[model samples]
Target: MLEDLAFPIERLGQAVTDVQLLFEKYKYENGIIFGHAKDGNLHFVISQGFFTKEDIDRFEHFNQDLFDLVLNKYDGALKAEHSTGRAVSAFVEKEWGPAAYRVMKRLKNVIDPANLLNPGIIITEDKQAHVHDLKVMPVVEEEVDKCIECGYCEQSCPSRDLTLTPRRRIVIRRAIKRMEDTGDRAGRKALLKDYRYDGMETGAVDGMCGELPGEH
Candidate 1:
């Protein structure tokens, strides 16, 4: 989820200043993109099935195009607010180029030659680290997957100031679903009973709207 890159406002496109228009042009159609455009920063998620090689290949190809758009065309960062972990570490050298990237590798080797702290996070020579053994999300039988955990819907949430948050609402649902799927009946019951109040009866679960949470 953290692999989504960032770009400059001017670099988003030639004429599009609006983030929504930029999204339309570049098309993060499957993602929910939102951020502090004032700082020329945005966060988005590409909800892809990462179980198979094909899925990894799709992400690799997508990253190729994205790298072309950001680094080659606009000179934007491969990373925004999010750090380049295993997800985008493969492209760090691309962003910094050979000389600078080699300098980065030397610095890493000098400090941590054994690769103890945060290995494969950055300064990696592995060309396929980004796509290797990608984590597969388990299936759940709830509409809660609609929530991207982007925190975009949290700040504006009224219940966040009062009772709960949109993200936490989905989180509770996911936990309950997990308990249910695992046949933890008692756990599921306790969770459902507790959530029946704020989650079910209040604004937290009003699908997290722009209006007052309970209005809908």
Candidate 2:
């Protein structure tokens, strides 16, 4: 899980240290920490797995601890680079205070009465909604599993306009792997049938995606 934490500009060093310590407490020793220090925005990516009930409980506790540390202790923001999506929706009220949060709720109700505009995303009543509907990253192959799904490879790929770009190709492969794991043979076969044309024929096998600076 990658979260951009925001704190007072002067407290960047302390905030980073606290976050690193927190990661260690949660047994996430290999957590990747980086970001815009000038703006006091620290982006930390921790490898989290929600495969079992124990994993989910651990994540919930870790997230609650993280929120408490950032919001209560440091007076920081959980979402600095992105909107308060489902990941941090339940904390919007705690972060903004009751009055401001009520105003935001009223504004949302007035603007979107039917609750159609990304309902349960920015402001949700379900406290555990963030943990629900979690994406399961299937281990397809060593190279494919390592992809972060960043679209940097799409721009330089020769097959960008022809068919599926490099990113989409990885996405389809991942989907296929999931289908196979779940015994969805029909779906896997169908996707593989199309992949031969869109992913192979139209794909540029010239190592163009690799020539870029980063991994493909």
Q: Report the number of the highest-lDDT candidate.
A: 2
Provide the lowest-lDDT 10-residue window in model 1: 207-216
Candidate 2 residue runs with Cα over 4 Å from true position: 154-158, 206-216
Relative to the true structure, candidate 2 has a C-alpha RMSD (angstroms) of 4.4
For all predictions, the C-alpha RMSD in Å is 7.0, 4.4
- Candidate 1 lDDT, 47-143, residue by residue in tens: 6677676767767776666666678767777777766788678888888889999889889989988889887788676888877766544454345
Q: Which ten residues in a row have the lowest lDDT in candidate 2?
A: 207-216
Candidate-wise lDDT, in order: 0.66, 0.81
Runs of candidate 1 with Cα error greater than 4 angstroms are 2-4, 13-28, 143-216
Superposition TM-score, candidate 1 onto the true structure = 0.61
lDDT digits (tens) for residues 1-216 of candidate 2: 878789999888988888888888889987989999888898988876788998888788889999999999889888888767788888888899999989999999999999999989977888788799887888766677677775788788777888988788888887887887899989988887887788766768843223211114
Residue pairs whose backbone atoms clash in candidate 2: none
Q: How many clashes show up in model 1?
A: 0
